[model samples]
Target: MKNLLIIILAALLYTIATGNTAAQEMGDKEKMKIFTNWIGRWEGEGSMQMGPGEPRKSKVDERVEAKLDGMVLLVEGVGKAQDASKQEIVVHHALAVLSYDKNTEQYKFRSYLKDGRSTDAWIKPTGENTFQWGFDIPGRGKTRYSIVLDPVKKTWDETGEFSQDGNTWMKFFSMHLTKTE
Candidate 1:
């Protein structure tokens, strides 16, 4: 009976040590579910300041999918607009991967643009249906981006802003999108 008690105590101690690890893994998966609402094909329209000129009208389309068993989000976006001459269609494409970093307790966003520009940003949830992500630009300012999901309206709104003082923000662009899939 003493031997059986010793074996049971050892098993109990092992479970106590390993159970927390399992719980943490489950927590990570649950945290990733915050982005499930964004998984779909979306279409939208917006305007952007391409240069020193006025904001030009643009048509935008995006596709977001949950990959790696819902551990990562893959996003593809395309924007098209008529050039100033109105004789050609200007197109821009961007791809992004968003994933959670368990070690840092933050979401990491990596994006690549057709113009060969790439950026890495840290993401965090700001509201029940909203998340904000961005990075600091040296010598310029900090650029931040946000996405708000409205499930009731089946719509998504995204915006970008720049802050010269890290407090006063100036809006740069915004897009309103409707879920197609």
Candidate 2:
């Protein structure tokens, strides 16, 4: 009788553990579907601060490709000011590679430049197609990044900004991305 009670208790423990593991696995898989539509080619325009009086507005072309490894995505693009002549101004270039975390339901963005420096940020989703992400770098200061996605119209708006105090954010530039084949 004692051995039988021990066996029953062991079986119950095994069942509970298996059930919990299965539930966690399904939750991770469910998260992958939430970010599916963001994978594609897009183009956008926005403004950036060049100096106290010189605010430069530019257009960026980005292509987001989804990798099969754990809901990861890579964003690569180039940006240039609308009115600046290549000879008169230095090139403002950016390359970003980022990944999504299913457990945290967040996106981690890291951007590398030609100068060999990189900036990392954490992105949080606030709405169905909207997200806010920001971070501070050595020289760039505190920056806030936000994105708004319109699935029905297949459009997206993105903004990047810097805050002196980190509480109030000012927009340096905004981009309207339209999906094109």
Candidate 3:
């Protein structure tokens, strides 16, 4: 009985120590440039291909703030239809962000919707001013977003793709945003 108790205690200690190490590593900050440039106010218009014959347009407002706690960044965003009827037809959408882990060296995107569900994304820069972010949904589907920022034009281009086979991509939404003062 004493030997069994010692074995169990050792296993518990091993698990706890491994878990703590992983958590500590995740909290470190790594990517700095990506977070700094993304900090600002942005506004744009977006369109979604709901179906072959169904398409919708909406306005997008995004705000990114630098967090004082280490290398963390906060983001807030809202999307609403321009037309009253369209607005009434669909559900409200909004997002609140806490912090981004720089140690992972990946752009992390998350949003809390009005429907009480939260979505998260991991992003990576593909080019100088281009980045890709993707999210996975358990039973529904997965979406990958590509964004491009033009400093001279002060505009942003975004495209969203949905995948089923994980390799095939289909356009789900597209947006063009102009920076707002």
- TM-score of every prediction relative to native: 0.83, 0.72, 0.71
Task: Provide the RMSD of all predictions against the true structure, rounded to 1 decimal.
Answer: 3.1, 4.6, 8.0
lDDT of 2 at 24: 68
- Model 2, 1-181: lDDT tens per residue? 9999999999999999999988866676466556666778887665677558866766767777777544566777666653434543324666776665655666678887777978788777788888887787666469887888888888878888887777787777777888874
Candidate with more favorable, higher lDDT: 1 or 3: 1
lDDT (C-alpha) at residue 161 in model 2: 83
- Give candidate 3 regions above 4 Å deviation: 1-30, 82-92, 96-107
Quick one: ranking by lDDT, best first? Answer: 1, 3, 2
lDDT of 3: 0.73
Ranking by TM-score: 1, 2, 3
Per-residue lDDT tens digits for candidate 1, residues 1-181, read: 9999999999999999899888887788798998889899999897766448778668888999998878889999988887768764747689999988899888889999988999998888898889899998889889988999998898999998989889999888888999999
Which candidate has the highest lDDT of all? 1
Number of clashing residue pairs, candidate 3:
2
lDDT for model 2 comes to 0.73
For TM-score, candidate 2 versus 3, the one ahead is 2
